[model samples]
Target: MAPPFAGGEEDEEARWCGLSTDMMEMILKHLPIADHISVSIACKSWRLATSDIILPALRAPWLLGSPMASTSLSWGFYTSSNGGQSLGLEIPTEFQRQWCCGSSKGWLMHLREPRNHSQYYEAHLLNPITGATVELPPFPPTVIKGVISTSPFATDFMLAALCFESTNFDKYVIVYQPRHPRRKKILIDNAMDIMFHHGRLYILTDLAELLVGVFDPRWKVSFKSIPTLFEEEGRHPDTYWGKLVESNDGVFVVYCTITTGAERQQLKVFKIKEWGRHHRIVEVKSLGDRTFFVGPFSDGVSISKMKSSSKLNIIKPDHIYYITGSEYSLWAHCMQKRHTFRVEEFKMTGNILEWFIPKLEDRSNLMVVTPTHSTSLLLTIIIVMLAVIGQCLLGWLSI
Candidate 1:
């Protein structure tokens, strides 16, 4: 009996469809992280291959907007690659009324307010993609300024937060672990920003000092000052903000300065140099294809080739993309061009805009495939393939 659509054409189709699993995996590995879930659903073998595959570490940064209201469980993601379109992500119910303190390595630190006066506030880490949550111990009622972690997925990773004891001036840092009595507090003068780089923690102070802390084998933290990067110019005209970032080249401190009522913003990058007792910070004019994304929670530098396009809209190489407290307005300071511009595409109404890096990991529950999103991704891939095929066919006919 002959089956429907079974002919010489069917044999050719079958042969074409029988691509080796290894070949399919290699192809999938080169695709963007957004398309992984869609490709996995194409067949059983592809799904298995995706399950075993480890994605590349390079990814572009997405802007994560705050949840609309206390009742809303959805947050908006503004992707520059998609022409700055905002995508709505439905978070878990536990995050419905919480405040997002910080985000690092695909994890968000959220503080849940107490339902009543008798209960204390609780903080937890959430992976919005996988809807997995891990609760920390009760936190003091202080205001949380920022949070950073040494890879949230690891068992021994340390979670630290910069907090203010009161509205006046008392500031401190708290480190959290997964075990009981989960927090340790450290008093510091004043910290403007905190960052984790290469198993050590770096803190920037308002007085323009850089402090580095290292943990001993017994887990005791020892703090030391890095060489003075800047000298006080006795009442400078411009206000400065400092951020510590880790790039492929080395650790850098980015200082952004804006003169009062001036449209242009200035950026300075300094590389850290250490040779035994000699420590120095050298100013550099070029960032070498690295673009930094700076915010209150975390500051990160992304290489040019890692992004979808060499230039991310107005965000060019050697530029720093940042948001100010003035209604969460977006701005970029270009080191190469020596100019600053406002990114008007970001129609922000509130203050909770932060840079988010989407990670595709093997263990995260957030990787569960959603049918609708995967379908849209599949359609996009198909259209791209069709366009390529059309171009090839035209070329072949001409030849």
Candidate 2:
């Protein structure tokens, strides 16, 4: 046999070739998900061994983190998959000047303003994973004309790039400064007052007018206004004030306080959903002011009677932590239960609540206050049973 096959080296090579693809795949599977990527480049054999594993595992990070962190005004990003390190992309130095954002789907949107002599404003969509960037076309001439004459108006431009409409994978840009001369229909002047809720962008332009716009990567890029019921209400416009609250189900509701002189004010809640056509408004009487005193506040122009509006800090879709001040004391409302805490009850001067979105795994940190409606009666039964069982002598004796 040795004489016939050169010490049987041919047999060894054949045995290596005879190894099953299944065995190779099994070895590749044992490697860490990240190292599996490197294993694919080991050789043609290993690359084939790893091809099917990349996609399913690569998309894991995309499906887990908080979508708001990627597209919100805070511009916060967190990833647990990459050793818990946030992706450090090179943000342009002009990012603050122009506006920049990252989407939940791992894409970035950058907006650039026109220079002294140029008439064009630039926007780009970038995929950091592949390092591919696509330049969005300039705003239409009419839109551009509208932005330039209104220098500060261009600065009021707000942008949202949504890769998928049904999902929360979107990016938002808010510009708070005036646009350059001859710039297009983009405005960021009121960008600071703008916030993204659900799939739409809402800008609190008025104590009255609420500007609602949809961000479409495939269109001319203009804000199609939605109807705000309070937009038409009367009296010293300064007397009527409002604030926005975003529900978890992607619905936005405005809590408006209309002061009737300095003593009386009415609190009204209006829900804004959809946009044109299907947009519906519903008034919620479930919430109201804690009889907080209406004040004489000034709106720059004149001293007008204004009410200290009930400030709602959204804890989640169904939970709102509202803070209101009365002539006697301060109050906090969570799940319709009102608790009054005096000005010095503990130690705090400003608003007591801070709103935040939790990561998928970190949700246990949140206090989920369930509504006490008929729907929660079933849950109440379960809780009461468990509590009784824990205290009953017979229950513990049987266990």
Best by lDDT: 1
What is candidate 1's lDDT per residue for 1-399, written digit by digit as tens? 122124685553343244446545555544664465345544443456566664432245777776444355455566644445554444566675677777777777888777676445788877665556777776756645545555566766777788886567677888765542536677878677777777678887777778888876566788888755666344433468788777765688888776654356677888888888655678888776787887777555555543443243545567777777567777777777777777775566563577777643524443333323354664564455445557668999999
Residue 392 local lDDT, model 2 = 63
Superposed on all Cα atoms, model 1 deviates from the true structure by an RMSD in Å of 5.9
Badly placed stretches (over 4 Å) of model 1 are 1-58, 67-73, 116-120, 141-143, 179-182, 232-238, 306-312, 345-351, 366-399
* Worst window of 10 by summed lDDT in candidate 2: 294-303
| Predictions in order: lDDT | 0.64, 0.34
TM-score of 2: 0.33
Instruction: Give the alpha carbon lDDT tens digit for every residue of 11-126 in model 2.
Output: 63343333345544544444443333333332343344444543323431221122222342222222222222233323233443434432322334455665544554576644
